[model samples]
Target: MSVTAVNDVNFATQIRKEGATLVEFGASWCPPCKVLLPILDELSEQHGEKLRILKVDCDESPATASQFGVMSMPTVIVFHNGEPVEKLIGLRPKSVYENVLAKYS
Candidate 1:
């Protein structure tokens, strides 16, 4: 599976779906955010059955980003049952994300 891109319009609906959702708030101009894209794609494919990975461009979807209190370029929020359970800032190793997903999955 591939990471789905969400904007303010569909952000709520997508994250509120019936499973664990990992939403990454980022912008195209950020270097770290660019780096994390492939990582997120890999994660989506690896854990597709148990996890739903989504991306929101902070530059384009300011409403969703502000609502989540995302201050950094790459803020990763793990949502379970429509509520945020964990948040990670900046660039992190793949294993770190895997560990976080372990709790929800």
Candidate 2:
């Protein structure tokens, strides 16, 4: 499936579902977040079997972001077995993302 959008209300349930999860804590208007969308979609297609990708709009889910101590606009957190395993902040090369997800996926 494509990347799923999770909000404040569904964050807990979604992250706890199962398997490896990469969550993008971002805002709609953030340029870096916008850029990451297509990359994430494409990456999801390639890694969907091993990963469940989710996106959360920080603007709409302030409490959720705050809970994660997300001080940046595009904080990507990788969760496996219901616990956070890795985190990446700011923009980076696609290979950088693929490398991280590859490790956990």
Candidate 3:
């Protein structure tokens, strides 16, 4: 499956029960978020079986955004077995993401 979209209602359950998850906190209006989408989508397709990439719209899920202390858009955090393993703030090269996935995937 492609990346999952998360919200406040499903956030906890998803992370706690889903095994492993990578979440991106972003907003539709943010330019960098927009730019990052295609890259993430491509990565998701490239690593479909190895990773579970997810997104949370900060505008729709304020509580989740606050819980993670997401002060910026395009915050990419990788979680394994309900714990965060790595985080990348702002825009980044796709290679960086691929490398991280290779480790935990």
Candidate 4:
């Protein structure tokens, strides 16, 4: 299960119609964002049917970034039923992500 790339085009539908949506706001040039990418991929694979990970390229979609109020790189926002429920900024351990998500899952 690979992380899906979200944009202004599909952001609304994807977040609104999902079981659980984890949106990663990142840029390809950011180092920390790069590090978080694999972790997200692994999580996506592990939680295949239960979770949906969406990657948003901040540089490519400034509107979505601004709408989400993502001022920094590697910002991760988890949504349930079209509303944001959790937000994490910067890099974090895989366990931390897993633990937090376990509550929602």
lDDT of each: 0.91, 0.88, 0.84, 0.88
State the local distance difference test value for candidate 2.
0.88
lDDT of 4 by residue, 22-96 (tens): 899999999999999999999999998889899999989899999989999899998876678899989899998
| Candidate 1 C-alpha lDDT tens digits along 23-64 | 999988999999999999999889877888899999999999
lDDT of 2 at 103: 79
Quick one: best TM-score, which candidate?
1
TM-score of each: 0.96, 0.93, 0.89, 0.93
- Candidate 3 lDDT: 0.84
Instruction: Give the better candidate number (3 or 4) by TM-score.
Output: 4
Candidate 4: what lDDT?
Answer: 0.88
Leading candidate by lDDT:
1
* CA deviation > 4 Å runs, candidate 1: none
TM-score result, candidate 3:
0.89
Task: Give the higher-lDDT candidate: 3 or 4.
Answer: 4
- Model 2, TM vs. native: 0.93
